[model samples]
Target: MAKNVNPTRMALSRLKKQLATAVRGHKLLKDKQDELVRRFIELVRKNAALRKEVEEKLTTAFSSFALASATLNESYIEELMTLPSNDMTVEVIEKNIMSVIVPVMNFDYEEDFMAQPFNYGYLNSNIELDDAFDNLATILPLMLELAEVEKTCQLLAEEIEKTRRRVNALEYMTIPELETTIVAIRNKLEENERSNITRLIKVKKMTQ
Candidate 1:
């Protein structure tokens, strides 16, 4: 369907100016969108590598923690083992992603490592293993957060691309079509005026 446009010489001039502005806007948006998409993809790859590292570390830590329990006196440790001292809070602030406003996540973690319940007098064990688990636990949230932001960035990039395409269409297709229509109408109007003037001149000549 044709865009809702009124064909007029003045209107065509206005549209031509608007098209120029639209083209400039499209270029800026496309550049921003391309940069954001590239950054988002790079982040995603890094997140994947970090995630795998975290998973492997946690798996090993958990297994060792399990073994420590199996070999040691479980009952004594159960009563004395308090939870690890770990605290984290994520704050999200505003930033622009391809002109879309989105959250930039900030992570905060307090530092305090808790020792194990009782030192195994003879069967050697690592208390820091517990600390390792707590550390990784804190990092898990951050990894997940990075993943979320990465996905959101991808979505914003797609939206920016879509908007740019619309702007291009208006600049290159719709407005041009309207301008052509306006020109045709204006020329026809001038031709009719010229023909009327000629007819009036002939009538005066005949009467005289």
Candidate 2:
């Protein structure tokens, strides 16, 4: 890299500037990577907890559903499942974390659904079916939250990878190349100065 560069003051100055910029950029990118990792770890932990809770709730709900299905008439249960109990609307918004844009989901649902979720008549449906529907209703928000956190972790991980590459390039390649080129140029310039001084001294002695 140093051999390719012109060993002149102008080249030296340019390389010095580039080295400074690379150093500064490396520092900034390193800081960003650190923060991204921190945020990613935090989201990962939250995602794990949310996933566990959602899975537990889903297991309980499915167990109740399985019991209901076994005890009740198959056609009756199928007909009841076909009916829509409530409506849910999800509004996705962007949130910035260390320059990474992640999704923030806002859920809008019928408030009445939480209060009275079951649509079928009590005479036809058993207690297990009611419990299943109730558990599903309770887990809805948690499921949405889990989705949001998982997505955020993905985005952060991608950003972190990109930042790490940039930091490594500046730290291990660009900055070092520029500094080496600058030193080579300075050494060449000093060598030329000494040769010029020797020539001037010989000329003065000849004139004398």
Candidate 3:
């Protein structure tokens, strides 16, 4: 159906301009959506890998901790672990990916997290306790990375959906309506010109 527009040359000019703008915007939005999907897929793959690795390390860490608990007194183990070992600072920043601002995380520690996290006597400490602590420290960065990737995936998914909606509106609705209106107006103008020419010829014949 033609758009609700006046069938005049001025209105046609304006609608044609609008159609041009809408077509350009549609192309740009479609391109952005494609790139966002590409980036989202990449992040999804990375998220899967990191999730697997983190889960594996977490399982290992829990197993070692459990073994250490069995060997050590529960109260003593809790007391030892309750003391803070490393000073950690987490910095959050945003990076723009296809106009979607996603989070970037940085973990800074004052001391080596991979080092022995306990300040207790070596003779009293179980090997399993040290192994568990090491594994936990090792996976800290991976956990943060997984968080970032997951959040990025969510944000990209939302932006891609939004862009797709806009592209569809322009491609299917707005552009088509404008084109129809332009055609209807052009046909009206041509019909009016023909009528005017025919009337002039009739008058000339009558005068002759």
Off by over 4 Å in 2: 1-4
Error of 2 at 202 (Å): 1.1
Relative to the true structure, how large is the alpha-carbon lDDT of every model? 0.63, 0.89, 0.89
lDDT of 2 by residue, 90-149 (tens): 999998888889999998999798877768799988999999989998998898899999
- So what's the TM-score on candidate 3? 0.96
Weakest ten-residue segment in model 2 by summed lDDT: 1-10
For 120-146, candidate 1 gives per-residue lDDT tens digits of 333344454454445555556557576
Q: How do all models score by TM-score?
A: 0.61, 0.96, 0.96
**Number of backbone collisions per candidate, in order?**
0, 0, 0
* Model 2 root-mean-square deviation: 1.2
lDDT at 147, model 1: 62
